[model samples]
Target: MTTQIDRLTTSGWSTCEPIAALVRSRGLPAITREYLLAEFSPETWERAEDATHALAKHFAGARFADEVEYGVLLVPDPHFLDTRRALPTELRGGDVVDERLPAGVALPATRPWQLVVSVIGSYGPSLGSYNEVTASDDFVVLGQDTRQWMTRQVWGARVLQCGATPPDCEHNERWTFTLFPGEELVDGQAESGTVLKGKVRFRLGKPNRGIGSARVAPALLIDVQ
Candidate 1:
């Protein structure tokens, strides 16, 4: 009995997992693994989600940062928290029309999907100039040539595998964050500016197989901020 929200979340997560897994791997101490291993509950997921955004905000600003020495470090960063609606499915002739369906509640064929991860201490000294966005493979890279990147890497290969064929050479690839201004090798040899804007860009990856398996998440461009 998949509830409406269940149908929405499960689908979105399936599409997001693979990409999220890879991006989440880039954190200083690593946190994505912990999230993946934990039980999948509405309460638990929400907690993890909030922590990601918090961490992002902590590290996103212009400042030096570090990690907590003990316990599973939980940070919140909206860039690391991906959420969107699910697509509509083919109705099997008869559908269950119930009280659960609110009056005039028009369910769209699809909803938004997201893939995000947070990192602490990733944007510090070593980050240098041009802003470095260190992210987990779990989070999708959303920027630059957004359309083309999605066409080949995500929509075509990552999501539409169809099971009959193997993953495309470009499918399930890792993310590469670009350093716009290029890291300043010298201490006092660079311009002063916010290296990291509201977002960063890179390729995306997948989650561990233990979770449900599916594909195709909502497309997010520069929305991580």
Candidate 2:
């Protein structure tokens, strides 16, 4: 019997060439595409297409102000670390340890889908400024809950210390965080909703004075119907 993976791969709707090209250009492994195909449902692919198209249109003629590397990942499960470990050595750029899920939170049995948009590399001055310009488009709207979670949870946990000795500190090399959908659990209940997850990796060092940054952050405007 032809497996679901085989059917999806041969169905002409498994992969988006433009998106795949972008992912490959950023040095993401082929397995990223594999996961997208095997895990993401058909509806999820449609949303990805819409989000990518909107992002392309938004940045049509804009000059980037940062050296940004971004990729889109559709995770069918909430366990991101497991997904990371399954990646090829070259693609698993860094490791996240001792991460913890929220207490008293119960995830759904049928893994709720997660759309992860990762922005890696250097930002010209600050990520906030970059986001202001790039994510200002109407297509990209961060829900209130999502915004709060990013501020309090994601940014609050600095996996690497990048603020002690200016650019020279080894700890200042990289600062990263993974953003999960806010309100995963609310009012003592878990609801089934398409989760939007974002992973951002910032490379901190001497400010890139005079050298402008290339911005390629892709925002997900998911419309789950």
Candidate 2 versus the native: TM-score?
Answer: 0.34
Candidate 2 residue pairs in clash (backbone atoms < 3 Å): 65-213, 66-213, 66-214, 67-213, 67-214
Per-residue accuracy of model 2 over 15-50 as CA lDDT, tens digit each: 545333433554433433466466567776665554
Model 1 bad stretches (over 4 Å): 1-39, 62-126, 129-225
- Candidate 1 local Cα displacement, residue 82, angstroms: 23
Model 2 ranges off by over 4 Å: 1-38, 65-71, 75-113, 117-211, 214-216, 221-225
Error of 2 at 120 (Å): 8.6
Q: Which is the leading candidate under TM-score?
A: 2
- Clashes found in each candidate (C-alpha, N, C closer than 3 A): 45, 5
> Which tens-of-lDDT digit does each residue in 1-225 have in candidate 1?
122223222332223444334334423222233333332345544544454444344333322233211011121222332111111122111222222211211112121222222221112112322222222222232222211112212321122112211121122232112121212222332111111122111222222211111111212222221
Score residue 77 of candidate 1 by CA lDDT.
27
